[model samples]
Target: MLLPLLVALLPLSAHAAERQVVLIAHPQVTNAALTRDTTRAIFAMRQRSWPDGQAVRVFVLPNNHPVHARFAKERLTVYPHQLQLAWDRMVFSGTGQAPSQVGSQIEMLERVATTPGALGYLEREYLDDRVQVITME
Candidate 1:
């Protein structure tokens, strides 16, 4: 029984180890780092500026995207469904605007890399020179 259980869990562990999500921003963004709480607020669409006070332009992949789901849960400690609900509530209630949505991670990377003060996240494998990684404190 123990051997069978170990075998069953091996693939799950391997898959988990294969993914690494990271916060990224336009190269021009002035803030060097952010605390986890600030990152959560920014991605949650609650905060509107960097610590330096530059306007924050947030981009996001479609809610159903795998990378989006992982980034929300792992980096922001929020569920994708919960994020959708929050965004919906904000939009419908006139409290806030939804983050600009991209159809794919490639597009998200492009948008953030080119847009001033932009912010978003991507899996490690998709990263390139166009954007800078925002280290979480």
Candidate 2:
């Protein structure tokens, strides 16, 4: 019985370990401050700008990556398919547009770290000097 329980718990433990999403801002951005709620709202198009008064521009993956999957499952509070439909509806209605999609994590980080007002997420392994990490908590 203990063995069975441990087996089940192993996957759960591994999942918990994967919860982190490394958020990064452009290197030139002087204000590195961000709250998780504010970040989420900004990415969802529910909020507009950073408190320091920079217009927010979000970069996202192309919706098939495991990191992107984690983002949708945890942060966005909606599935990828649902988010896509909502994004498309907004684009068609002109309410707002979806965040610009980058081809991969490398591209997303590369672009975000250079573009003003840019934000993107990646695993910690991809971290580089060009981007300032935003604490999600």
Candidate 3:
């Protein structure tokens, strides 16, 4: 009885769970020296591209986006609200602004894939052979 119901709902749940925005770089990207702090710096536009020689562009999900929440916590090492405070703090301190935000995972994926020198995040589920996944190493 319940088994059939659970089986029926599994696909929907799997679909819903497919929203992880993996950071990515170009296929020609050769350097793997980026750490979370460095990645944050680059994504925030605080730092530029790799020393190995590639143009740099940064991207992000929208301000209130749930995809951004994971990035804010895990990579940026701050909460969304806290990150907002950090940006404000930086602004007053004569520092930099945050990365420009895209509206959705699909948009982010498309932008980064099509734009040269671009870097961005989109749900891992949305990833294909189009972009090269950038890992923090």
Candidate with maximal TM-score: 1
Better-scoring candidate (lDDT), 1 or 2: 1
Q: TM-scores of all models?
A: 0.85, 0.77, 0.72
* Comparison by TM-score, 1 against 2, better one: 1
By how many angstroms RMSD does model 2 differ from the true structure?
3.9
Off by over 4 Å in 1: 1-18
Question: Which scores greater on lDDT, model 2 or model 3?
Answer: 2
Q: For residues 38-110, what per-residue lDDT tens digits would candidate 2 score against the true structure?
A: 7667777767677778888888887788888787777666677776777788789999989889988889888
Estimate every model's Cα lDDT from 0 to 1. Answer: 0.89, 0.79, 0.74
Task: Check candidate 1 and list the clashing pairs.
Answer: none
Question: Over 4 Å off in model 3, which ranges?
Answer: 1-18, 85-98
Winner of 1 and 3 under TM-score: 1
Extract clashing residue pairs from model 3.
Answer: 20-123, 20-124, 21-122
Q: Candidate 3 deviates by what RMSD?
A: 3.6
